[model samples]
Target chain A: MIAILNAYRYRMLIPVNRTTRVLAGLTAALLLALVWAAASGALGISLWEVLRGQEDPFSVQVWWQLRLPRLLLGVAVGAMLAGSGAAMQGLFRNPLADPTLLGLASGAGLFVALWIVFFQDSGAGSLYGQFAAGFLGALCVCLIVFGIAKRQGGGSAAVMTLLLAGLAINTLAGAGGGVLAFIASDEQLRQLSLWGMGTLTNALWRTTALALVLIAAALWLLMRSARELDLLQLGEATAHAAGLDASRLKHRVVVATSLGVGLCVALTGVIGFLGLLVPHCLRLWLGPSHRLLLPASMLGGALLLVVADTLARTIAAPAEIPVGLLTSLLGGPYFLYLLMRRNRAC
Target chain B: MLTLHQAGLTNTPAIAPLDGTIRPGELLAIVGPNGAGKSTLLSMLSGFRSAEQGELHLDGKPLRAWPITELANRRALVAQQELPGFDWQTNELLSLGSNPSKSLVAALLDDLDITHLAKRSVLSLSGGERQRVMIARGACQLLSRCSPTAKEGGILLLDEPTSALDIGQQQRLMRQLRSWATQHHMAIVCVLHDLNLASTYADRVWLLHQGQRIDHGLPNQVLNPATIAKIYAAELQRIEGGTHGKPLLALAP
Candidate 1:
């Protein structure tokens, strides 16, 4: 028995060691990206000099007021989106499931657009108002998709029903946003279009703080469900037989993903594909165990966004491309490639 | 032990009320024609579906009343043709949802004849191989939680467990199941299509026709050729006297 246990312990160490190594690597890369993003903007401000107070006062101000909050917001939004994506995929038991694909982001964007059109001048455009609108939109869409899935009787059929529901919600939300855009004034149009394009330029200290706290809470909830998510991959009935409260798990994941993805869309304006791309790639690297996948996806996402946002700002200096455009540009082709490969395999 | 008192489902693939007691150290086979509600009956037995007419009791308490986790500790179900949603190593799949000892996991893999497939991804396994892996997982779920001093190992419910297996694999699996029932004092209920395998391995057999259990008794008494042929609506020849006088059934060519 002792010998058998020792062998098992040694066998278990392989995955644990790989998890530690991968997480450590991701953390180091995230720190490097943070420093790099902080340093390379419109104004070249070295992080070391900013810390030492040797940079000019104006450079320090730019670093603190403009760059720091944006970078922090980028980290929070990216982590939340990717973590929520990983959790969502696990909950639905489909690798293709994503917050954006499931219409959560578009729903949130529509509500934020509504807030911008009607409530902007009414002093309801505060962070709280935007978050509430976005959260409600996401929650509503999530419940609808979940309801449709439940009605379909939940098997492979439910997965297809979920995706179809997402498609319908996405179309409806897009049309609503277009209507909102059509009626807006020129100034409001510019704000709406820029927000729709998804930039971190509007990142403020207060919004950044709010995004961090809420994203952290959502991510914590998702991570707490890691084991249950793993069990769910066995299919719902089998998972329930294994002692999981399947309905409760579904509710928790639905709420967490809504909160996380909604807050991200509200703050960052529908940053496309970070949720889909980060978790999908990390699953290939670390396998599908959520105990490791969730945190790895979170760190990987933060790193990707920090690096991508830095490029978005610096690549065309003096004017910035929306980071959303950059991620979509990269993620869209990869998504097609994944679909092609899956088709070929089939 | 699992006791069913007029338990049945009213769903589309309905089952008439069934009253039966499945005891530890016994392997009970539920054999029926396709669309005969065999799997539905298994689901009711596993407590995945509530009995519309009556109740199921696991140990002494109502099966539905037992907390899910505690019930999981007492029972495990292996469904038909389940494909895992993600790629998991064979051993990882075996130990999922339960913390079985290394020796127990190894033993299950060996018993299932898939020890060599332990490190391979479950997605890479053939259909028969994956079926065995799922059965081991079900066994692990029960045996790991079973207390040493407990009177019986928990119930294991299987739905068409041998549907994907070849002849050799089917024989090995059935033998292993019988061994587990005898050694671990586990009550096992299997929905099988092959009546001969049931007759050979199962201590008792329940023959179903059109959602109702028409007959259940010792294999020899219940699986007699005349009733099986009538219920199955197929020509069958019963070869008399083999291996302790158990009936050997074959289709009429």
Candidate 2:
């Protein structure tokens, strides 16, 4: 009976090998991060109190309303950003592809800044507007990058063009944001800067709910194409020869990535390094198969962001550093380390 | 059966109007000098590139009419040397070629004499070993395309299957391919640069030059001294007898 089951398992495209172990480890880490984030805020609430169903007003307000929403939003935003990052990396067949690197964050940032500076007075402050405009901006940048890359043909040439276009778009968006910053009032400037730094301070229940839905949908799309993504890493011609519809896969991954990153930025501002850091480091640990990598990155990203946000809130108690700033601080050094290690290996 | 009825790609640099029919249980070896449309012909035959002016049919159905998934199952192409983007076990890599059963994949690995390397990352394999693995992968694709009971024969398309192999390895691979062609009753078209190997192994040879078919016949008839001299622009001393009763041709000093 056991042998028969093993035979069945072995035939599965994404087999059960090492997946359970990885999932278990990530789940443990996630639970730990969740408990830590929920309990260690400015208004301290123990996990025990929350577990025992505390009904005190302060505990309810702090734990359920504030801390819980923030933690869950961080989880959704991180998962979306990192899951999209993994898909982008697979689509481009490059290790350096991240939402921030591809101008999704910058484009969304520019739109959000535009709204904050120009449209805030005209009732554009709603959560729906923020998600709609920001996601649209991200989707536009992603599709434009994809369009330019497609024109360049396949393989490393397309990936190179996509990266260059990303850099150009990011620079243009940054300049636009700079101009917006220059003309804004002090209050507007502060708000814009805080948003730029990346924070989950705006993790209200309504926005979190929308982010969860969008993130879940995007992740589903990415997961559905996991096998195709794996084939794509063999190079576009190779993938096509292997019977994958390469163009269709690219379209799906691009659309999913944009929706994911767009909503992520809208919810938590432009959180930078989680996308790049999570997938790159995980690829080294787990190898490069997207079936495992995509789902694993989602869980891992959620865990990392929750921990990072916990640190952001607690390290300087009563004074919160934007979670984005904390992530950049952690992610920047790691990126450099990876670069040096890769250089040495090469 | 695969037939190319005036199937041609005139705009393509290396291939002109190609016409041929490759039937099951036959082995056709394509030989040409560099930039002589060998790979291009194989590409069209494998349905990677569509014929510009004419039609290509497999089992009397136009190549384009076949769904990609079904076509992929029936035809597998092993292109020039490819380096995977990540480290994959040899077996895992082969599985990506087609959805073959695990037992079948293991058998293929054993048949290709790469069973020992199955657990190793493909990145770590030598070029010759990688080539063998690639051929095995293609074979697995053909195997997966057929049911155990029905056994629908398929075609194996290979671009320079032995380019990196040592002489002994090359002979072993050729013998293995021959056995596969006969046993599975699958059509095999291989692009080869070495004339001697083609002469020794190919049941029929197709010689091409300047985007045109120079000759197509049994190896001895097509790879004659006069045709070699004219197409290759080199003089060669043609020896009388070789292994398998084929003539041996060596470059004249």
Candidate 3:
């Protein structure tokens, strides 16, 4: 229902005046919903009680240790992946582009495989080992993608190169991960498999706080480059005439999007389509102006992911499903719907 | 005030190779072949493309030197097929013309002679109406100057203004332009395909071929039959020559 309303709001065949009003309304709704969902996770918790002047140890522990951290991480992850995808779409002018250009997913996956291989049986250094492996692996993949993208067009090649590079590395990492899992002892294999599927289960206050800082900084940078993103849709030459410096904007978008993607990739093994689903839907509803499109995408993407995260915990009576699996299952259909609709339009 | 002297802006694949200058309060017409660099030249002068060589000045300062807002405040350009229609709420599309007085979108729509169609979808307007809407939007940018004299600062860059309009609509627009250009003293730099229309209204014409300025002067000098034949690679018969004796070409054979 909201998507249809957005479609009407963004109808270029109609006047922009009416569309603007409609988009404004839609933006307000999405924003309110976003705030409501984030707040709901800690509705009666200790952090909420503290801020509201009610001291309760049990609620505080639950809020700070669980709900508060999850809320922060969930919103950051959703917004970062969604905004990164939208920026990439505008930068390369291809709607299919996603956050994986950094190769963080693959890099992280490889590191996780190594961690399991070397330290799976050991009890100590587990958390630090996972973080180090994931962070290093993702960073290495980003540098490699950047290296290959440089050969193709430096800052401005068709997005196909990025997608292709991501696909190859993603496949290699997936293969390597599979092989490692195949040979692991039964107990280690189960643990590796469960973790690999992705979860926000070990949510920590410090980790969530750090994610917020990185995500917010990245979002701010993306907003600054948005005007140039508007110009990009018309092709590089047209954008340049619109007084945008194309190469400069491209560099900024790629780097900032990488940061957003890298952070999320490190935190969650590999979640797809938050970026794809959000922007594409918003474009259909709000038209293509980046000012409205970017924020709207963020709001919708964050809300969708948060809801998925909630379902992940509640569905199996505390036997959790990896939020990544649910996101893929739900998002895969939404993506197919977008593809079918756009193809018909073409 | 805008000035371009021996300006040559190069983009990949030979899209820009034209030379010319546009000044305050004067309407200059750019007429040429499809790949003749009209878009490129316009982009360069409007601060979108950097001229690989040549001097372009806005208010006597180099175009590149002007601040983004200062440049936007002074110059407004509508590139060809940048917006197509005929549907956007006539008023909604018009609002994009000027940012400050955007609240008066309805008034602008009425002034453009489509008030009745204000409620209609933008896709429903005729091609001529769509062209008028583009001009109206460009005018919005000019309105932002707000100088008492109107001519103190204003430049409009339009590409293919009449190609979308019917003959009657063309005259209505051109007639309005005479007053609008004079009242605003707008430095109107437009790329047009119609020679007769160019001769009828434009104060000056810049003729380009293969990214080169083959001719630049009064409409009569630029729109001659021999020149038209050579540039277009077509035969144009001279009959009913235009104002100042400029030959009108109706493709012969």
User: Which candidate tops lDDT?
Assistant: 1
Please provide, for model 2 over B19-131, each residue's C-alpha lDDT reduced to its tens digit, 9 standing for 90 to 100: 78898777899998888998888888877777887899998899999887778777888888876777777878888856788899888888888999988888889999998
lDDT of 3: 0.69
Q: Which candidate would rank higher by lDDT, 2 or 3?
A: 2
How do all the candidates rank in terms of lDDT, highest first? 1, 2, 3
Model 2, runs deviating above 4 Å: A1-17, A50-55, A118-126, A147-165, A185-187
Q: Lowest-lDDT window of 10 residues in candidate 2 chain A?
A: A119-128
Clashes of each: 0, 0, 15
Model 1, range B169-202, lDDT digits (tens) per residue?
Answer: 9999999999999999999999999888899999
Top candidate, metric DockQ: 1
- Candidate 2 per-residue lDDT, tens place, A319-340, comes to 9988898888888798779769
Considering only N, C-alpha and C atoms within 3 Å, which residue pairs clash in candidate 2? none
Model 3 chain B weakest lDDT span, ten residues long: B83-92
lDDT for A155 (candidate 3) = 36
Measured against the true two-chain complex, the DockQ scores of the candidates, in the order shown, are: 0.71, 0.46, 0.12
At residue A187, what lDDT does model 2 achieve? 96
